[model samples]
Target: MGPDIRTQSLTKPVTVAEYLFTRIHQLGIRSIHGLPGDFNLIALDYIPKTGLKWVGSVNELNAAYAADGYARCLGIGALITTFGVGELSALNGVAGAYSEHVPVIHIVGCPSTVSQRNGMLLHHTLGNGDFNVFSKMSSEVAVDVARLNKPSEIADQIDHALHECWVRSRPVYIMLPTDMVTKKVEGARLADLIDLNEAPNDPEREDYVVDVVLKYLHAAKSPVILVDACAIRHRVVEEVRALVAKTKIPAFVTPMGKGAVDETSPEYGGVYAGSGSQDAVRERVESADLVLSVGALKSDFNTAGFSYHTSQLNSIDFHSTHCTVRYSEYPGVTMRGVLRKVAERVDLKKLTRVESPAVKNEVKKNYEDSKTITQAWFWPRVGEYLQEGDIVVTETGTSNFGIWETRFPSGVTGVTQVFWGSIGWSVGATQGAALAAKDLGTTKRTVLFVGDGSFQLSCQEVSTMIKHGLDVTIFLIYNEGFTIERWIHGMEAEYNDIAKWKYTEVPEVFGPSPKQVKKFIIKTKEELEKLLKDKQFNAAKGLQFVELWMEKEDAPRALKLTAEMSAKHNVRLED
Candidate 1:
């Protein structure tokens, strides 16, 4: 073996593009999504040959969203696209993913160094000789923004991007110039890594706060845990569940954290801040003696605009930035470690008498009742229509309402871009999710409930669907505008309204193989029923698009309640 070393000598050194591709592989990226362009030719050439799957999208925006959905299921998401136009189009999705704490690696290809120096207007540019659009948006959305100015910066920038993802729990951006792709430089480490470092709390404050929290929990006759999206984003679900179990507290989760604890838990009361919530659940939360808000954001929608109708008697607020006790002059240490320590001291026998079989029954009853509302009614019906194994991706609008109302059967899964609440995300994300489901060998169907406005923004993904021959169901809620915005801000008759589509004609417009693509126009509830009952609709092989015409004036449960509550307080709303 030693004698054969010289005979089996290695070939010539690889280019920077080869090295970068190798690094991306080491980062555990299953696929790279985006459209190819002149500027990014080098990375594009290296991508497929290096063994990374290329999930090419029809456009940059859809590519970015697909990457986001992929990242949501699989830890890290990545997208590769050309300079200015491509990167700019993708910025919104990246920003949304960042806000929601989705880890995404953005590989943008820019013009060659010589062209940039000459100040030439590149393709996808706004007549300006710069490809800095993402840089501008990242000023607001990204946790960290680093430009790979030199070839030497690539390894470090990638490392920094991953670090930002772990520490800040958000998206990070890395810009790669076309000129730098094959440039020679010293490469650092070839992969990303994250290690947890336990930092000590301020001893004086930690002790005081721990004592107060313990006394409050021990003395309280009724204590409950309130979990939110923050808990999920922080990866603290186990920690929070441990705390709840130790304290023997009944747990009520925010709408976003619906699945944090099993819906079947004996101590679980259904979610408290969404369409499914009942007046009784509201009353229960408002009356509890000790409310441990573990990683709660208290968003306007979640808190009913912070009305404080909930029991303010002994509120323990735990947020990433601050921690405070009710009516306390001095604040306590952050919930970061205090929660774990608190969980360690709990008495599990402190179970409350409130845990009744009735609560569990009510969860089922509430789901049925919620289906009457405009937002939720669709999903319940859609659920009946769904096959045994299906993946439903919901957009940010009436589509989300439908998913919220629809219960997932044991083998089905649901996804939403809930963290950022960005409109037009579902259509693009659905393509990505479906692609993922296909790769996993799950014979489940992939379905999307997207809004008219959202579809208009990212509809180009239809081409990708056609190209891949993916069997996906796309339901476009044709409300003609940003339905959720209209409900929230009452910007009725504004530009938020969308132009209608001959929805059932989409596949025809895109050129269809009827086996792989079909479209439906459903106007009334009865029409929807007929569509759902039609076995052919579910069994059709290509891309099936269902255009459901929703009432433009339909109001969601939360919106209707908020309006009523506001009127009761005489809060003025602009017409």
Candidate 2:
């Protein structure tokens, strides 16, 4: 007879690395993004064994950026890096995820437990012998931090961190020491699936809040629904959309909430960014007697430097974990659940339908098909070219502002780092988004709009994109420098200038063959128009890169106004 079955079942053992990666795999993480470091080498070895693909990134920062992108597309993402140096390098990217509410598990490999107890100075350390410094720093950005020193607590710690990540939709940190990578742990815990479902809310509190919200809705003569970025981050886009659809109310998206709802909807109004908003949007939103703002983040950029005229007395705000109607606030009343309740309880017949401005008003400015490209000519045309199911990523400068003028089709996804305002984030983010889209078997193309200055910050990730055979289309805005910065503070300063590279030749230099990639340099309206209509280009096969040249001083109207506001705030007032 073989070995006794009962004995094997009682004490089956597996490495800690196996346990962690297996747990991550169960959470639907098909690929891990990071760079190789000395401390993480052993842990990296267990990646393939656990049925996960290691996406070797160009750098730790890019790895984090890619992980954020992947998380937005795949629900949750994971990244691995070594201690101090590696973790610090990726902090900004992780911070961006934290700010925007993306769920990413940041696993950092540290020195062995023995070294930590003995206080040995390691290479990645600050020579202070204390390894808790980085964890403390990470605590500020991550929702939870888990330091796995004992093998017995590893499973519980991992499960807890992951649970927080999913429930909160925020990043979490896990420090796994080198010695603990191979430690034997009970294998039976793997049999239990991690619980990611949101906990039950108090029924009495939820019902009370819903009743108050309906009272306001019933009293208002003119009301509107405003969708923002948090709706997408909190996984409540469908709820917000349902609320708008059932009520047939005029809905407008904030700058950060661009693609959260279908722009093609009949009830959709344009973007609302305070003074920078479209004439109709500004008039309608500010004039409304009541406003239902869902998952709204009133950051400087999103609100056009706090220029909104809406009064708090008439506003009802819905957040991830709470709801506030005018001055009264209700904690633990989740936006997702509240939206569902509102949708179910709302009386459509009692609600008034207001007429919004005609969509044709957006096309009032006519282009003469000029040879030289202008911001006025570029944005509207690009808007016309956007297709359904395209994932659009914009950098922090001109791209972000100009994209606001473009309307996305149904099923399109928009990705930007507005609140964090990190430059050069779109390059790495596009790579991860493309990979995620591919993994989901979606034919959607990854389209990125980045300024030349921002592209230079994280351009090396293009190599990773080519290596994975991802279908991505890059529209590199070549204006010779940081156009947005110039508009903000320094119009002619040398600090805003950047080296101009042969942007069209980047794909060829980055290791993709001519046949594998398509390149274009567009300087005129005719050229852009021709390229947009090309069947092969629209197909977005392999890697497609277009270098779009424009005047250095040209910028979107919204960006110019917002930059002026920012410049005013930056100045010191001598009272």
Candidate 3:
């Protein structure tokens, strides 16, 4: 990661692509995901040279999604695409990262500067001779856009963009012209790594906010801590855990915050998603005397179609940019500093401790004897099969909502597009998560639960995963249609139906594995249980695929509740 070395001494100059990738390598990004094209082929050559692995994806869109998932696991991720068509295809995935506050660097390669300035008709252009349209579109979703047009300012632009991407935990765009890829830059610049530390909160404001939070926290008779997604994105999981433990109050998680808190804790309450939650969880959260909201991103789906009844007056919200103690807001006071201070300064003796409600992932016996798998039984059953070090990835449809019922082990990591609710995300995300887990050597397995309908969009990434020999387990649920959409809209419409492809043929159609790929089809709960207990399957020595046949109309209780609420809201008259 240091400056270049020659025969006798360190070199002084290097290519722009070399400098860029070297900086990315220092950020702990071992793998770069993207598709190669005429424009980016030259840049791809520099990736391996910088001691980074190049993951050639099936398409630009999957590459972007893979980058997002990789960022969630490894803290930051990067992807490269070529020119207008490639960049346009990756926009939706990048927008999801922006919506969820994931840090991803999107680098797009374009035609030469001479070609752009002369308004030459490029193959991917719209025939209007405009080269800035795609970049302008990306600006909407990216926190910062860095164009490497000037040789002198390129280093600063790249540094600033990467800095913003990390500190803000959102996507950033970097445009590299073909000619700029080979342009010379000072090698000495690589010696000094870019500053990626988060900005500190103002001491005066932080202390004041902490005092206000303590004032309310000490007076409450029955207070509970509510955790959400931004706690993970802002790198404050430790602080959140510290406060929860030191305060000895019951802590709960939202759907998007499943992996933020340890479920094995004695004070850990079940998930709270308004009307979608279980009766006990809903009553416990809504009836709390004071709610310590940690990094809450209250999207409609996350809140069960905005059914949450907790008023702003009784809640104290902690955000990365501001801290809200009831009606008073303190700007420049972040949660990381204030949470730690409160945990250190507060007197737990004066606080009331409410016992966490009894919560367990117990499978109901009603469907225990059923022939076919129902969502009611399947999700809870999965809890028994999941291991501690597993990374569970879910699609935006059934799996996202269904996972609310599956109690995970202590060290598990959950990945889902809850806020964005984009279909077919789990397939690509599973691949990225597998690679990230493998890279970090921190997880035992990466598994995905995707619907048969949503699996059609980015299924080709399974080939990319196979090529990399990623040890992934895929659970393809065959239900004949988008059951989630049926719950929200037309139930019997043909538009909701999907082709019943031979899903077991994926390994044969895609590249044959470096290691043997195993496939299975289970129609009954007995078969699924047998497969789950199989030692070979649990080992996850290689890629494994399972096709589970289930009833179409049935869904998880959480999705059923939220979809019905969403259906009524969809037809509401304009206010």
Candidate 4:
């Protein structure tokens, strides 16, 4: 009957949502983290049908965070939200992902074609149009923009945005018009696109920079390696470790660059973040005959805004975009090629450090004595929980603080948004990381220790965790406010305090079941231990919440030191 009555379909027609989902699938993104808004309804309709999960987020910012987190763990994050307000809330997460060099795909729904023509005040319109905010954010973070102007551009744009994010390791925005989502498109397959161009890595400039760096390394009696965040993101940990071992030079990591070289290595001089920085490290850096800074940004925060009060002199900066042989002179080269060349020509055998037992003891003493504050208080225990293959994705406030106090756990990975300092990043990142862990067949648990304020931003993504049956546990430190901002600005309580929630109830509120997904709220150390011992609570649940009811004054010592550093440097804190 069907053969006689109906002709064979000439071609497969696809909706904009189907095209987008297919492209996202090709990008290897299996889930979409977002809250369905009025404008984004069509994309939501296609989620379940297209085999991609529509993971719910309580807030747009958190959805972005979750997407970012997922991207960090899973290779790329995809977020869907309405225009204007939704995108605005998610910007913090996208910005964080951008700074941290995580590739996140933001699929924001714009007003329909009719609304665009009218130019009237519309829902989710921020005066200058919905595109203005996202475009500005993308530009600021070195992100690529792919607008789906015509319905046909959906697949091509999504594919392009995803590819760009992988190439640059930054977030990219793909704006979807509401009208376009339900419209039909022809031959919209992202997998069919070809990337014909090669990324530029200037060889001549790299050689010149490498040659200059080798000259100093060959001549210097004491050569120190200063590592930063870029080195970590570049997956140069093995190279850094090899260099540290070959040189036998004391390696010092910038605050953002902690874990580049293992902390247990004989060469590690501890992290260089002003107050927490070892005096021995400060002195060694000051006295070094040659200083090789790899992937260092040398911003005010790392240098205490060039305060150099603790240490000074003899630094040759080798960074991502540029280099410096002298304090004032600029040299040309890309960081990776230059470092790769350094790994090739340096006197790998002769570099050795004079044993300094006293200095080592002093560094250990400093680490032990750091626990007088709330942040440091948790590190030693948290350090114990960390294992090989574990990945730590931290929120803005705690990211730096954790790095400052905690030495990189051997074999554990750390992810953060130190460059952008975006808040509400931790929880979002947790979901993505969990997905990554599962996909990679790693036994290591994905732990997210976000500040209470940050957790509230994307805490709703717990449902995604539940849906996937991921082994993700969140340690929500309920300090009840924006602790970082408070410390940085010394703001009044009104500016800092966040809304109170039954913190442990997050998993229950978002998860599939209250019994399967356990939530524990604690104020004291004893309660934490009791929950820690409860196997049923932590095991095999879709999600689990361990909330630590902390005091507003209980900021990490390193965070406090950051505030102190900000004040000393006279850097204006944003309200």
For every model shown, what is its TM-score relative to the native structure? 0.79, 0.97, 0.97, 0.80
Cand. 1 TM to true fold: 0.79
Clash counts for all predictions: 4, 0, 0, 6
For model 3, which pairs clash?
A: none
Top-down lDDT ranking? 2, 3, 4, 1
Against the true structure, candidate 4 has what lDDT? 0.68
lDDT tens string, model 3, 1-575? Answer: 76434312425777889989999998989999999888888989899899999999999889988998899898999999999889999999999999999999999999888888999988988878788889999999999999898777787888899999999999999999999998777788788989988788878878888888999999998899999999988889899888888887999999999988888888888899999998988898999989999999999889999999898888999998888888888888888899999999999788988888876777875365668888889888888899987899999989999999888888888898999977887788888888888778764698899999989888999988888888899999999989899999988999999988999887778868546689999999889889999998998867898999988898988998899988999999988
Residue-level error in angstroms, candidate 3, position 380: 1.2
lDDT of each: 0.67, 0.89, 0.89, 0.68
- Best model per lDDT: 2
Model 3 misplaced stretches (Cα beyond 4 Å): 1-11, 364-366
Candidate 2 contains a number of clashing pairs equal to 0
lDDT of 4 by residue, 388-448 (tens): 6667777778545755656555666776667676666666667777876776666777777
Off by over 4 Å in 2: 1-11, 360-369, 572-575
The TM-score between candidate 4 and the true structure equals: 0.80
Q: Candidate 1 on 1-575: residue-level lDDT in tens?
A: 35534223423334567666666666567678888888787778888777788888888888989888777655567888777777778888888787667777787787776776777776666767655655666657677776766654555665666566655566766667787776654433443243423345687887677777777887777777888766766667778877766655688876555556544456666557632355666667767887888777655445443454565456887655456777663343667777877787655565343551224221333343322224546555565666655776877756654443444443455567654677778877877777776666556688888878888877877877777777788887777788766655656766677776666776577776766777677777667767777887767467888877767777456545544444444555667
